[model samples]
Target: MNLTGWIVYNGYLPGTKFRDFAEWIQRAAANQGIRTTIYKNNHLLSCLTSDSVGLVDTETRPDFVVFLDKDIYLARQLELMGIRVFNHAEAIAASDDKIASYQVLAAHNFPVPKTVIAPKAFYNTGADTIDDYQKAVQLLGFPLIVKEAFGSFGEQVHLIHNQQELTDTIQQLQGRSFMMQEFIASSYGQDKRLHIVGNKVVAAMRRHSASDFRSNITTGGTMEAYQPTQEEERLAIATAKVIGADFAGVDLLIGPDGTPIICEINSNAHIRNLFDCTGINAADAMMAYIQQEMRHNHGRLADLP
Candidate 1:
């Protein structure tokens, strides 16, 4: 029997970008003869009762979900209903929070920049205390990076060159979870994005910006096809595995001596840019991986308790 899948994306996000991502995945699955449906995350209402977990989607149930949304609750809800979700909800939640992602990487002995997570602030509590700021400064030093735990497209990332700048940024991001990290001057305006599918690197690219510290394409950076060294490839694959992602975009920074250090892992990374840069359709690889997994585990996933 043919398998069906649901590509779930955020419904409330403005613009076509989020929806576009789902479509790309859907098309890739269609190319392989897998029937796929696009569902807005909000359309699937997660329902819970004292003794039951259920989701209300008017459409037919799918055998699996290609979850492209950051709505962790919705993802988990679908999982509870016995449908497999690629990139898993827990992985998505961890990847969505920069601090959580860093902690997971560090725990697994992955090479990462020195990082110090800010103390959680109560809501409407105003600015953070100066002592906490001083602690982070002492740990990470000046010219460090201040990044909100939950942000994307490098928009919430700030470069702090002094105590004043650090403190100012902290105040500006009051009541939000964030972190400070050592700046890798060697990778100031460039980084590599490796798209890992299953156990291997399917595509890679170098993103660089002449005018910005971040190399994210959303920030006007340019992309070029990249060849990953063995070390870079291993790090990318290991990081993705440790984070429990079936597929991921792992960003790597060059350390002082040219060693690769992980910058971040993106669980719901879009496939369009990787396709444009490397001429490799990551969505195709993802769909193929899913089909292989389903076949290998045929008549077994339903038996999973």
Candidate 2:
């Protein structure tokens, strides 16, 4: 497949890790004979004028884009320009918002921990009425998990053990978007991550954190190669498709009955950790999927019968 594209990641993110992701994807594209240019999202300013959306760019637009950031407007702008973006903008938005992701998953009848979305409120404005919070706490019970709608690496998730604790936690959040979920005790310090690409589970790993209730690698979790059960694999694949992801890192929690439940879905899941743990390069799979899709969409798939 002959294609030109752009790989965009956040430029202000202060770390070599994200840039490293872009480079790895670029290398994969190169191996497939696809030419790509890397761009920090900020490098291409999104221009908005009366009746038109465009990017301030002097260079010619590419055939497609591999967007690794959550700049939804920019992704939409690219779509408006007829540039295909991997993991479509709508999907990214759903995945970026924890509340939205759960709503979709529940609508599809997937198994998820009991969850309650906090009502919209301002930071300093008092949620003075603990009445609503009390009802939610009663339904979810103590030791429930309070998670911000928008967060990564388990940093925004907190384990609340009591009514007062819950109130304190919310107060600390200062009106940020958050939700409450039933704590999966069986999966307290360990969870499984299955990376899927184009309907296939490309890699799987178990992440464990002895020191924390959260099992995120960024939060002191350790990784080890693990094989997913058939049910686990099925759930992961279904989840990626349900969320409309080209590729995703689906986190699964162990239900009390030992069944897999969706912990989260990441549209822009970092591949470096998966690579280090499973030795599988998801970028390769991602690039291959993109190429096949691009060619098929352009009526260039050689396998057409």
Candidate 3:
């Protein structure tokens, strides 16, 4: 009656962090009597042939897949073959791109910082095709935030204090997808990360940095276990739902007036930091949720071989 699944991650990424994420999920699944195999994205092939479309040499398909990497194409390919994919491919893609995620949030009336997506072009389209700097400056004012659409751990986020800083940063990011956002000065060096499973916030933590504008734990910030306010919980859960995430790490910034505002949504959030800060194993909660999803879909753990 044990469930079977595959925890897929990007093998191309350096260091043990990526592999470690898969391993943690594997162990958590094991704790719930679910058997899971870890696979690198390169370990499988998504074959397209006139006669058939499938993954090459995939003998037995698992009941579901836990995608820990941002391999959207592979995730979609797996879905095409009839295997259930957690978080879903589209959700991953949306969360992977800051502009896309922000658009979704804005459409849903979620409270996200004011953001302006840069124009698309192979080369820096120059000021001719891009938004007028004066207009952007007027909207967001000085000391705004600039974020590359595709980045992680606050590495690609920059704080621009004036027009020259914005210009230089944009020049360096030519041909890249990015956005300019309103700076939340009150939460400059602090934010809350809430891990959501199903429709509830399971574990929460507050991260703060003494020397930087970003408070991401991966960027030398300190974290402490936190109890989320009702508004914070509501915003986090809503973000996950709108993004179609089964589980996610939702960052909330404290507004100047103490209101909760979404900073970012991570579809494949690393749970180790959350566990370290709160003593709650989000992986365990995710596994349990996956089991319930299977059951709700009329599939039983006994169906696995």
Q: Write the per-residue lDDT of candidate 2 for residues 1-305, one digit (tens) a residue.
A: 47999999999989798899999999999999999999999998877799877788545989899999999988888888778999799989999999999999999999999999998877656555456688888888988999999999999999998878887888777578889999999999999999999999999999999999999998999999999999999999999899888888899999999999999999999999999998999999999999989988888546578
Worst 10 residues of 2 by lDDT: 123-132
TM-scores, all candidates, are 0.96, 0.96, 0.95
State how far residue 241 of model 3 sits from its true place (Å).
0.3
Q: By descending TM-score, how would the candidates be arranged?
A: 1, 2, 3
Q: Candidate 1 has which clashing residue pairs, if any?
A: none
- Local error of candidate 2 at 124, Å? 2.4
Where model 1 places Cα greater than 4 Å from the true spot, the runs are: 57-59, 299-305
Least lDDT summed over 10 consecutive residues: which range in candidate 1? 123-132
Better of 1 and 3 by TM-score: 1
Candidates 1 and 3 compared by lDDT, better number: 3
Tell me how many clashing residue pairs each candidate has. Answer: 0, 0, 0
